[model samples]
Target: MSDFASAAMLRVLVQGMRELGLDPGDAPPGDGEARVQLGLKQGLVQRAVLQGGLACLPLLGRGLRRLAHEPTHQALVAAHSASDLLARWQRLERYVHSRHRCVVEHCDDTQACVRHVTVTGQGAPTAAEDFVVAGVLAALLESIGLRRVSLSFGEQGLFPASDPQGLAQAAAAGASALWQFHWQGRPARGSAPVPGPAAWAQGADPAWAEPVRRAYLHLAADLARPWGLPVLAGAMGLSTRSLQRQLAAQGLSYSRLLAEARCRVAAWRLLYTGDPVAEVGFLSGFSDQPHFTRELQKRVGMPPAAYRQAFAARPVPGR
Candidate 1:
């Protein structure tokens, strides 16, 4: 059991590989509870499976934006403050792997949060696994609207005040690693409203949903550009029609998914970045200024400039 990971985690890796136009023949067979056993080496699982996902993140464009919109992941981000989001993120790990434990702490003065994660019932940790954990944590924090998020394995004199060299050795020996996350000014209201746990549990199928959602995220950054179903299907190793059928089964379509991705990215840029509204629109894959403004008004209920002005002026928490 120490060598085994949950099917959900494996599925994310498989999906990522497919999105990258690579063969996912490495994944174990079957689905559901009976499909729990993933017959692969732990090191391979980390390197090929987990690291593979991270490698394809850039191609997915605005990967965090896609993740932030995921129904289940969104539920975790539905928090009042940075502290609240961190707590929810820890709880969300249970849905990923049963053998892992994530613990988070905040400094009283600096308000910097450190998450120490330990994997019990597992063999020695590899650098690949460490990278995956760090990548996932960074994405989640960004999705919850945190800025200046940084991940480090062992930094000297950081939280818990341990020797950096010893911490690195311990990490290689399968001990916990520390992830440090911070925000500028103070915590502010997250971009989207958090959904209840029940909403997360409903219609949640980790096997299919995880990968398909990942595919959408990978393409999120280029939403303003023209993307055809065939292109997306090719990336996912499916015919255009097959892709359509699969998404339909999950109550999604390529157009809807792309729109949502653009909306989320535009909203994040308007709220967090100083980039011009036109640039945000262009980056979000809008064809032109009018198209961008119209869609943004429709989805966000205001033009980009207005949205930024209204929200950006709000008081930062603990300021």
Candidate 2:
């Protein structure tokens, strides 16, 4: 699990390959739970299955053509806008406990800047894995009736990628395991409210290190529950000392994870709910508004209100 991907993701890559008459041999288990994770150490041999999945533009398209039929594909196609689609994507990551995660750092009418990353305190995902994920995402957009969707990976460039070839070229262009996913995906359909962070753990670390993952999930379950270390530990069926030791092994503190969970809840409300900022703070377990503002400011590099305004600036699909 720590080094592998979900069975669903691997199926896309493997099935996509088979669709193009390519053989993806012997995909490995992610965490002994039947996940076909790409690579933990990122060794070349470990990537054989992932690499053989798709090689070029035409092959990539033919390989991934089955994406539209998958159960996940059906759910993603229901997304009313690009933001809603990604919100759904983030939610799915939690359910599958994926090692890698994607986050939209910025967006507008014609472009969305995303960051491909691993969960906190985990090893980074390889570039090849990132490329395959990018290919799948592009195909997903196409399924949603979106056209002219192009993607480019870089730290600074916001240029267009006219075809899948450009995305493949940029995947091998850098050794950096983590890079920006600057893609063109305009939001579509009419607006609809996204589910809250309770159902969708957006902007929070969902995997890596079992204790931390569980702690974040518990915290996100109910931010305003007046939870403390003893309470959380008790709920997880561990003594306080034992729980503390587990968290220490991961270099995390209970309060820190709680704060992060709160931040995620606040972000979801800001984006999808028309709730007042004060109300958001209260529901996120902040007894004080100033502390909520300060904590969220540190994590997102902006105040809650402004961060909402900046990241939610996308246009309607057809207009």
Candidate 3:
């Protein structure tokens, strides 16, 4: 992904974290700024937040970079915790919106800028969250004084029944991009689409910062793989062993990431599709149905069949 796309992804991520109700702020020791600077220098930001949404920080950082110009990219990895990134995103979103008048202009068809996110992951299926996030971002753009916006998502994103209008409204207002879980080549959860620069860049946020955005795109595209540690490591230009060490510094591992991705994807699939329990398991990286059932129960508090029965019966937004 280009730096521009990375920055946009970051913006959406930070904005989403704020909506999740976490404290995303700078620390008193000037350490917060230092961390960000360091992350820039290192060209990466790696963190694992227990309950604070650190996973979304890189995206936030990418967004913030567009507003400022700095050279520290490699040294910046593993800087802020997820909480810090969220706080920064909230700050930036407010900063941008306060200065501009945002608008939403839907394209009769998807535009090139909008295609960046979708093209990053090979064979990845687009999700409703992409549309949800885009709408939320449009609202934010309008709030910031941008005059026009044009974006679109796949058919899955269009159905009123699948993506809720209320959630879309909240996301557009710089709130969390309400998400829904689903799978493509592998199990994945779709996040709200990041706002485009044309929509968010109103001369309020600084420019000239390129590295942060680069890192953001790297991270976002990196994470989309399904249990391919070697592949992800290669994409980031790190050796598998080195990658493990870096992730260790931030309290994460390939296995854990794989598990998290699988669980979220499985949860979404269970709730969204009519796929059989065994198929959901297989698609989610579970080799056996029993293991899939056990894991589903652990994460969702119900067996796959039961979870589907319950979710299928419930009313969904934009359904």
Candidate 4:
């Protein structure tokens, strides 16, 4: 069918499943000119922790990260400008020969939004599939060296990406999924450098953590304390200004790190521990129960209880 995904793309999902400690129960689709059906893709994603929650972004991002080495992504990375990148993307859609693909609704110097619909002007029936699409596009953007990039997915006034309260409301949207992409222009260098890996995906408990990650650990150690930049900077053996510059370079701030740490810790506890959701949120740097539910809901794409149940349904690894 025209609504099919590339085998290379599906393989990335397989890797994400493996990493999440989920069993690769069935053989994922394989690469070939013969198109693999979208049903295969839908079946694969249905097995994930949740359909569309905050966790979906990074999980899909993690899977699509493999695309950095694929041809479509490589071509996108090779694009010289933001508009140029869109042009190349249009060309890639043609090359795929899929009726269901992303089409640019508008473009400009600052921000642009792409609508993921079919030639019939319909969005993917599956929410998770659309998410996979957004993740790939986001990866391509990051490869272009736009360090501070975030995306809003919904129709106008449904939800702005910045409004924490409305994420899930927009997420529950039906067909006709839209993606509004925001990014900073490339650095003031000689020319647009070749697209490499998206720096944002360089997270998780890597062998060597980023400076911001070290800062995350420090802040995570005590989420209740109202620590400032100076104290954290000193703890990291960096001057206040130096720490600010470093965090800015990585598209991070101390508060952002603290929030992220809480999210990470909360997710971990929900999945592997029997702690009550309220208690888990409290220990993860959240002092207010309602605030904890809201933030984690924004991040993980659901309430704490729901998130725990989603992943908890998965077949644990090594069992």
Model 4: residues with Cα > 4 Å off, grouped in runs: 19-24, 27-29, 49-54, 57-59, 120-123, 154-168, 187-319
- True lDDT of residue 129, candidate 3: 30
Arrange candidates by lDDT, descending: 4, 2, 1, 3
Q: Model 2 lDDT vs. the true structure?
A: 0.57
Q: Estimate each model's TM-score.
A: 0.42, 0.46, 0.29, 0.49
Q: Report the C-alpha lDDT of model 2 over 1-319, residue by residue, as the tens digit.
A: 4454544556565565566556556644222132344452233223433455324322243243555543334445556456555665665554445767887777555556667788856666555566556566666565555666665555322122333344445555753233333334454542221235557554556444777677787777655444689989987888999988887877777877777788887787677665455446655666545777898899889987787677753521210
lDDT of 1 by residue, 171-236 (tens): 456544555654443444546653221222222335557656755654563342245788778867
Candidates in order: C-alpha RMSD to true structure:
19.8, 17.5, 22.1, 19.4
Model 2, C-alpha of 9: deviation from truth (Å): 1.1
Compared with the true structure, the alpha-carbon lDDT of candidate 4 equals 0.59
Which stretches of model 2 miss by more than 4 angstroms? 26-64, 155-319
The local distance difference test score of each candidate is 0.51, 0.57, 0.36, 0.59
Clashing pairs in 4: 53-301, 54-299, 54-300, 54-301
- Decreasing TM-score order of the candidates: 4, 2, 1, 3
The residue ranges of model 1 lying beyond 4 angstroms of the native Cα positions read 1-64, 95-97, 107-125, 156-176, 185-190, 194-319
